[model samples]
Target: MAAEETGLRVQEALDRLTGTGAREAGEDLVRELMAFYGEGLAALVGAVAPEALVPALDRPAAAGLLVLHDLHPEDVGTRIVRALDSLPRTPPVLVGHDPDSGTLTLRRAESGGGCGCGGDDEREVENAIACHAPEVTAIVWEQAPALLQIGSRPPTAAEAR
Candidate 1:
């Protein structure tokens, strides 16, 4: 069957299951299929040369698949770093990661001009992380500190030489 046809069939099945229990059962079936495919993916990963897989990490969809199945050889930190490096704008510096809480801490890049709040930049970063490292449940942003200037007294008219 075509991919679209398969998707439609799945949606039709989901639609038919109206009750909570039936819906849960359908979701469970999907999860089972996902696990089955994940195993197949693991086997495929094992068959392929490790170097060949490295290139796939650069592509978002492929990388997400690899990460989803936990078949990507690289560690989470390495993948997170790769995601950050791929950012179009100045990438944030990784402050730390708490695996227990699945929290990632990052220091936002300082902008030469503009508010530097980085609302859009943060979203991009989050999207990249989701693609590469879905295991990160939360992101903590560390805003850049304000610049401080030393106080200086202007020379008064009487003090002028």
Candidate 2:
């Protein structure tokens, strides 16, 4: 089944429990299942060679699950880069990521004049990063340096005379 269908089914099951006054029990059951599956995923990751898992990442469902379980072979940075690269529009340059603070700093794409506005673009970036690297809790923008202009120096007083 597709991921969406599976998610809807899970929601329906939860709702059915909620309607029957067993919401807490249903949630607990879900948590237990998640723990069980997480252990399985962890074991699979340990047994398989890292390169063997790379092919699975091509499928969004598999990639998401690996990330959700924190069992993806790639590091957070690699995931972030992959996310950015997947974007249709020009992607920002990654300045740095601070794992301690869960902050990712990025410089806006300097080309195409950058739209000079960020409402839609910012949300898209956030969504992409969150989907790929949920570990990143914050996204920070790094301001590009101001442009410099070159001009002739002023003549000395003696030269002016």
Candidate 3:
């Protein structure tokens, strides 16, 4: 699991501990650990940051940490464009990037065959953006999602030959 997934799981466990006296202990432990490690991460960012951003973003762990702390040197729009360009399949056409709201709008490419999965592509894209460019708070699809058609219906009891 990624750092984000691990943190979410830990948070869920902590929430379950609430109303039990151990909750405070868990909370304090988390706070202290975060402070200790966050300080180290900040120092590391200051010390070894590459002059170019592509290097930092190319490393998954480093990219996640930079995004978690808002220390990435690239602007939100640039990151969004880069993330889209990295997609393996037909990439979404860039509609717009709103820095003020941190929302990215994308439309389906008109020339490609549709996956017909009803926005699974969008969700995957969103997840990817969250990993590589957490600055984007939301992704809005300007085009309607493609819908998959299931195979022909199975024969009923009376319809069987």
Candidate 4:
């Protein structure tokens, strides 16, 4: 089906789920509908946001869901991460770095740790830290003064000069 048709279907399902005295019944219907259309929505998103899909394309299941619905990788990752983060305790950490630009993007990592599951979690963490090296460097630079203030004693006359 076309995107518009899919959207209309989803909207109608949502209306039925939320409309009138049968709120609970509608909610159940909405959940079922969401599960049924989730993959399609993912594919639709992927088609519109190809740049975002790059990161998720490597993962078979995630990529399949995206391809099935034409969703972007980034959107897949974002949604997955958001869902993961909402769970209680030990949220995964996502950290990205641009070395030359000295920029960092830090957020919770995906729930399942992507392909880096098992013992590789350490490596993943290290990689994230490395990616943010420039940001770390800047933070250190900014803290130097405060660190010096904390450690230094009063200067002698000769040192003051």
RMSD of each: 4.8, 6.2, 12.4, 15.6
Off by over 4 Å in 3: 1-19, 115-118, 144-161
Which model is ahead, 2 or 3, in terms of TM-score? 2
Candidate 4 lDDT, 1-161, residue by residue in tens: 46576567666767665557467656665665655678566556646755764665445455555534444334433443443343344544444434455443444344543552334544443343333221222211111112233667789999999
Lowest lDDT 10-residue stretch of candidate 3:
110-119
Q: List candidate 1 segments past 4 Å from native.
A: 1-21, 149-161
Over the stretch 26-115, how does candidate 3's per-residue lDDT look in tens digits? 776576556556666777768864685567685767777777777776777777776777676777788887878888888876655655
> Which model is ahead, 2 or 3, in terms of lDDT?
2
lDDT score, candidate 2, position 9: 57
Superposition error at 147 for model 3 (Å): 20
lDDT of predicted model 3: 0.72
Better of 1 and 2 by TM-score: 1
Model with the higher TM-score, candidate 1 or 3: 1
Ranking by lDDT: 1, 2, 3, 4
Model 4 whole-model lDDT (C-alpha atoms):
0.47
Which stretches in model 2 have alpha-carbon errors above 4 Å? 1-23, 43-47, 151-161
TM-score of each model, in listed order: 0.78, 0.71, 0.65, 0.24
- Position 149, candidate 4: lDDT: 38
Winning candidate number (TM-score): 1
**Ten residues in sequence with the least summed lDDT for candidate 2:** 1-10
**lDDT (CA) for every model shown?**
0.85, 0.82, 0.72, 0.47
